[model samples]
Target: MTKRQRFLQRTRSRLFSKGAPDYILLALVVILVLFGLVMVYDASVIVASETYGDQFRFLKLQTVWVLVGAAAFAFTYLFDYHNYPKLIVPAIVTTIVLLVLVVFAGPLVFGSRRWFSIGVVNIQPSELAKLTFTVYLACWLAKQKQRSGNLKEAFTQHLKTELLPFAFILFTICFLIIVEPDLGTTAVVAFTALAVYFISGTDALHTLGSFFIIAVMGVLGVLAAIISPYRASRVSTFLETIKSGYAPDPWISGYQINQVLIAIGSGGLFGIGFGESRQKFFYLVGNSAFTDTIFAVYAEEFGFVGDVVLVLAFLMFVSRGLRIARNAHDRLGSLLATGITVWIGLQAFLNIAANIALGPLTGIPLPFFSYGGSSMVVVLAGVGILLNVSKSSEKAVFR
Candidate 1:
């Protein structure tokens, strides 16, 4: 059969053979959101109170985002995800336009122009771009894999067919984000897209070559960081603290992380006990701190046990997502699952890693916990599509 015929067959089968959504995944999502709500409130108390004079300001906005996200989740979950590829073009174009517009017209915050403040709502285009780009890739790679015909061609002709288009798309998205100078979000997108490509059944040797390419890109990124005084200071602080167990300025350069580490350590084995955290009132006291180091507040309030449970919960979420990808009946579903999973999983890892000093402080928000409307909505929507894939997996697709 031709590729079109195969694609039609899979779509038809999906429409007719739909199964119930995964309740375990659904239940797990609820638990995480509820826990995150509590933590966001906990972390944002001082910041909200001082900045907005209402301790409930961030929490209320986040609640609205969560509700909006739930609507987004419902939309993706109920729709046939097999049809997502059809909308890829307009979706991606819209995202790119938004990204470009945000660069020129969005409100400037800190040093980067990354958000559009429209009336009472603020929109971050990069978050939407990340999602749209993932859907585009899942469709492209799945179609490319279908057309490759054989393993030899899949290897020999892969670069021309796969990497060229993939590279262009990936570079376009990453370039916009990097120009925003938001390396944290850019890293998440690139790593997630690379993971999706690697998981799409490429050759082992080519995967190694891909790794080498990524290494070169990483080196370039480091060089770029070194050239900027602000970024250089962050790197130096990270390195210095790593080596000498101290921050340059406990209230300025590395001060944020210095406070974060203190929060984590003071938590002891059982945390400072819920709403009794001392760090939020003084050091980690700001709206930015919620996104940058909310995990530290979490660690301080919940202690070691809370940390373990949260990490384990995220691990379970990722494993189940990967399992869905492994069992997806079609290439599109499988690739989509992989991409979405990597997107969520990597952000979670980077956020926590930064908090614990396991990685550079990227200021990336934790998936559900951080107080950002754009991210919360986009991420929950991704989870919705992932659950839709899980629903499809139960119909004669098991290993």
Candidate 2:
């Protein structure tokens, strides 16, 4: 055979020799993104037309974000996953700096300064923090694993060496996020970090101790909430909704949650049919119909059946993520996979629960389905890291 033909043959063999990164997971992600684009247009068309004089304004912006996210996904997927540890320090530092900048310079939107407006694009540092913290924690835990001996030694050493730093970093991030008045993101980041710590093979005693620390933090968080009238009002509103089973007035405090419930109930078994949702027409209040409360608008359009499909897609994504973690080639890969999975899954659950009134309105958007550029980019980048890990594991097993 000619040299060029032989080279081509070898390239094909190398590419196809090992199993590819989980195609099922990739397919599910693509489906969700496509579905999100359609829903974003359906939910935002009227508002876009009225506010911006362009019916496709939000749709067009969301399409651009999806393209940006796709590029991020491709870059991360093709890059080596094992090299992420080198990025841990930079990631942590960048997040801290941006968060501080947000406090001082971020644009105020709806009474909170959680986003930096660069011309037309708004960047939420908290979203970047979530992904950065996950990467940092994964690297930290993996290093902890390598440095320690057995379970008992690991536990003792972690307590002696790692506990203080870990607590400091975790609380710093959480404090910054909460001060942004974004309690939902704070909780998600805290929980994701704790999950990574637990899965890092720490002893049972250390795990329990970690939970005790988290509980103490939780108590402090509750006290902080009670001290703030704005937060306390949210608590009261939630309680009132639970007690009365609906908001007392459509124009009052619990109006958003009530609207969400109306949308869900109106969806019935098969939905109101595509872009036919009446709630998006200034009934749901605010831009939530396209952002945090997008799920309700979705249900209103596609019904209970669509809700089930979306839930199942998330479940499948989580399952595939865990499977990748299980078969990962290294401790870092495993922890990174687990952290990303929990971050996305937990956020999605909190958003859905808030929509259905199972939890207080948290203002947390659904992953991949919400209308935000920063969140879409960060989340898709995380998924790229996960796919890279899966690819590495496949290569490890086959070669």
Candidate 3:
């Protein structure tokens, strides 16, 4: 067999050593990636043509990223997932430092400095930080799971073992991102951390208390924004648009959300039949066709049916991820698998929700489907790690 075939066979053997992976998850990922490619091309064509004078500009860049991401995924699959826990601290530290560096040394764009230029490609440290935080949290939690007796003991144990370390790391990261002022990414990381805490079997009362505190913090944040002239203006514009019949001006604050809703409405049931989306043709200015608003393009073209299918796909991915967690060979493996799964599912849900106006506009990308270099690469790499975990889970040494 060729090296590639050998690698696949060996990994499959290990993963199925416990039992075969649910094919549904793999199928869903494949389907989403393919659909994303089509929609990305469709949504970004006009923008690409306008900016680069080439209709295929965005498509070509996305294709390159996908190809590179696939290689990353493959490399992760060939390694052992359990080994990652050993490297968690250093990885987290590196990410944390990068987060700090981005604050001082990163380039500022769109009123945020979340990106660090690494040669030709600008890298978002926060994206990698999300995964690093999850891995570190999982390892820390799994270690703590051993010392607890009852719920109270577990709660206290978690507080000392998990929360303290997590707090320092999370605060450092969040502080940097807030300085960059990428509220959306900070929110995503916070949500991902909450998901990990929830799945790690923390006490409900404690978790609820934490949630309440977070909610209060968020409200306070908005209140602080209300006092700042610019942030207050942005908030006021969003509220005004919602309250009034239509936003009178599109050039300012409400433009992106307004245009997204319009694109969704224009698509109807079957979508404007692909590549015919009018909003993408300069109707929407700030929202990138392939990234934050990719779902809008999909909805406009695919309509309700298409939307339903995307939801179903997410459900399948979550189901398989949960299943993998259940069958994980050891505590570390289980935690890693669960953390990764929750991260992906949570992001997917949040992105789709934002697109449909179920929530406020958050600039999060749809996993695998949104046009972004770091997000796509990170997600695929995550999948590879999960696959590796599945491979050795059956024989995992659970201490």
Per-residue lDDT of candidate 3, residues 1-399 (tens digit): 899999999876744455444445666777787778887888888888777798887678778888888898888777776677688889988988888888788886765676777764778888887788888888877776465668877767766776666666666666666666666676777777766766776556457746754774475456436433454554566566667745546766677778888988887777767667777877766437778888888888888787888898888888878777887878877888888898899888888876765555657788988777888888888887777776655533221
TM-score of structure candidate 3: 0.85
Candidate order by lDDT, decreasing, is 2, 1, 3
Candidate 1 worst ten-residue window by lDDT: 390-399
Tens-place lDDT per residue, model 1, 1-399, is 999999999766655454655566678889998888888898888878877899988789889999999999999888898899889899999999988898898887776788999876889999997788888889887777444657776666876787667777777887777777677888888888888888776667458647755874586477547444576677778888888787877778888888899999999899989888888886774565567788898889889999999999999889888888887878889999999988988899998988887767766889888888999999999999988888878553223
Residue pairs of candidate 3 with colliding backbone atoms: 14-391, 15-391, 267-300, 271-300, 271-301
lDDT of 2 at 223: 54
Preferred candidate (lDDT higher): 1 or 2 = 2
The full ranking of all candidates by TM-score, starting with the best, is: 2, 1, 3
TM-score of 2: 0.91
User: Clashing pairs in model 1?
Assistant: none
Q: Which stretches of candidate 1 lie over 4 Å from their true place?
A: 1-18, 145-156, 212-216, 219-228, 395-399
Q: Cα lDDT for residue 380, model 1?
A: 90
After TM-score superposition, what is the CA distance of residue 204 in candidate 1 from its true location, in Å? 4.0
| lDDT on C-alpha atoms for all candidate structures | 0.81, 0.85, 0.74
